[model samples]
Target: MGFSVAYETAELISPALQREMIAVTNELSSDRAWLSCEPPLLMNRGGILGGASKPNFSPHPDELAAAKAAGERDGTLSDLIQILCSVSSQFDVDWVISHDCSNGPLGCIRCGRCDPEVQDQCQVLSELAEELGGCDLDLDDL
Candidate 1:
């Protein structure tokens, strides 16, 4: 009889955090083993997840405008929060922020107009879509 392996995979890790990451990967997978690495630094000499990227204001002018406008009216998270607040009626929903600097993900940004009373979620996103400014990142493309 012959034995064969199907595929191989690896994860990117920082030199300092390699051991920790390996331990986590081992805990998760019985077969897959974690390897050591230096975290991929895209632009500068510094590390990722800690570095910031310049927000592209050109690609998302309209969206940005709406976000800013909505943010001004309420805050940056207003549009997304309301949309979420509505869809979440069925279950206990909490905001999950996927923090990826390379992917340009968002956490919550607060505003003045946020109302805990309102149930209409569509209204929130709609108003937000309108108010998007030069770099309304949270909303979809204009």
Candidate 2:
């Protein structure tokens, strides 16, 4: 299959979807309801050119496990990326948004604070990644 950059900020948010990524591994959980109700995780970040910051919550792993745990799930990852894409799109002017998976709520994954949009994005991305096999799943299409 061929691939084209679906989201202009793909590189920026790619880290959250990185394979077996350790950045935000600890935050995600097996609870689908939690993810849906409150988003996956938060992402604390500054400008790429600025100083490093805290981590955030994401849904990459939990969703992957859920999908694998289940049988059929397609919108999982897309839901996530859509959220991310939306936030990135909105923040396109003020900041360079991405899925850095850093600086969230906990110490494991991206630990810090993130906007609701980023959290929503991560949740959607996580859901999609999970259904698609997470890291092994190629979301380059987005």
Candidate 3:
């Protein structure tokens, strides 16, 4: 015979909390295993068990940059980019960033609202995109 249990994100608690919960459960059954998973990308919200209060959310420029930096530090970004490039080359499809923002891939800057600082930031993103052999797609087309 087999048993199954299912729960929603609201039921997920912190690791320490989980340990306590597991201890309670273990008293009834000692042969159970536990697993946990987190969202792949940096979420704008909804991290807690009950979910975020805001209905809409998106990644900020700084958050995107930090995520990129962390990925590069861990070598995950490089590995993923290499794999993408190889696959894209095989299919002859150009790799590009697609989004609704006017700034670069990170989507931080507005086109007409560009100040000196915004220009510098956009320039940096453009250079980075070029270095990666990818370009930002104009969201206006979509």
Candidate 4:
């Protein structure tokens, strides 16, 4: 199934539903297997698959570190990090320069930051940043 459909289905069969199913099954039948089987473990809850898991959906740090170490062992991590660092640095520089030229967040306002020649470049960078994911950095941090 598509991701959204799968996520929605998972959302529907929440922890509450799991508990209800277990309780109802125990009431209707003598089998007590459901009682021993924890809902989280059985359902792979709070996993990469997504569910009524942890508040943070991101991968666990150990998993990420292991993946990065594996990639490093294979030499892929070096190349990937190089490219990512280059791109991220360029984006940071562009964002900072644009914001500085824009003068105090009032936005372009006819400033050279919005000059026709560079407007498209800035817009593309903004779109790229958004695609990368929500940035926690604020103007003050910049």
Candidate 5:
């Protein structure tokens, strides 16, 4: 497919690393057999839906440096929670959960709040707040 179609899919998915993913895709020289087995690395992927759209999938680049920089920045508990929910359904949980931007079909914002400890703490706090008669926190507001 053309870049235009891929870009449209990216827009629809709202991936956290949109610019980076696009850059990686653009850098690709040609289609190869390795694409299926050794796809590019992505810092954060929302999740792919359609088999028909598989060719559009762009792997992420080596992002250790990027992840470190991202870790230094501030992130939100809500983002982590969303990521957790997305990966919980999968049998290969570690692969999906470890990424900084593993959200559901709607995708994540790669906010760097993917730490398990922090997510657990947020869950506890949310539960406590609910038990204490507080109004439910609106997800959209977070």
Candidate 6:
């Protein structure tokens, strides 16, 4: 298994959900629970109205092996999902856009160079290049 990034963009359906997410973010900060390689980055970022949790690098091989040896488990998408699910009752989300595996056609190659925890989530970036269709995306901007 290897590690890959997990990114999710959510659309909050209600002001109450936004407030709840903000509270959760505050709690995460206060608890100093925003550890790298484990806890994902959760917040309303990039001028997005709702929120997102983008785990840059998760299911880290070293961390996973260590945890396994220690009889524990490493972080995965499920971990990120659980964090959001905690506020599921109070959070009304209309939809969520998820991106896992490599960065995209402009990024990773699925070389298996890194053992991925969620192999199913990993996809060939080139296959997604078509989704860009006729969009003009400057490489430098990306």
The count of residue-pair clashes in candidate 5 stands at 5
* Cα RMSD (angstroms) for every candidate in the order listed: 19.1, 13.4, 20.2, 20.6, 18.1, 12.5
In the range 19-130, model 6's lDDT, one tens digit per residue, is: 5666774564343233223454545544333333433232234654665676654433444444444444344432232454434422211221212323334333323333
**Poorest lDDT segment (10 consecutive residues) of candidate 1:** 1-10
> How far does residue 123 in candidate 3 sit from its true spot (Å)?
16
What digit string (tens of lDDT, one per residue) describes model 3 on residues 11-70?
234555444433432342222111111111111123222111110112233544665565
Candidate 1 lDDT over 1-142, as tens digits, reads 2111111011233545534433432333322111111111122123221211121212344543564565433222233333333322322222222222213323321231223322233244335445543343542244
Candidate numbers, best TM-score first, in rank order? 6, 2, 3, 1, 5, 4
Q: For each candidate, what TM-score against the reference?
A: 0.20, 0.24, 0.21, 0.17, 0.20, 0.37
lDDT of each: 0.28, 0.35, 0.28, 0.28, 0.31, 0.40
**Regarding lDDT, does 2 or 5 come out ahead?**
2
Instruction: Give per-residue CA lDDT, model 5, range 1-142, as digits (tens).
Output: 2211010122233354345433543244123332212223233334532111122122222332353455522122243244333332221222212122223232322332244644554465445434432333333344
Q: Give the lDDT of residue 32 in candidate 6.
A: 28
Residue 27 CA displacement from its true place in model 5, Å: 25
Give the per-residue lDDT digits (tens) of candidate 2, residues 1-142. Answer: 3211122222243343332222332223233333322333434333121111221123356664676577534333334334433443443412233434424321111122234665565556556534554344433344
Those runs of model 4 whose alpha carbons end farther than 4 Å from true positions after fitting are: 1-113, 134-142
Better of 5 and 6 by lDDT: 6
Model 4, position 71, has a per-residue lDDT of: 52
Give me the candidate number with maximum lDDT: 6
Off by over 4 Å in 5: 1-16, 19-80, 84-114, 134-142
Candidate 2 TM-score, C-alpha based: 0.24
Off by over 4 Å in 3: 1-75, 98-102, 106-142
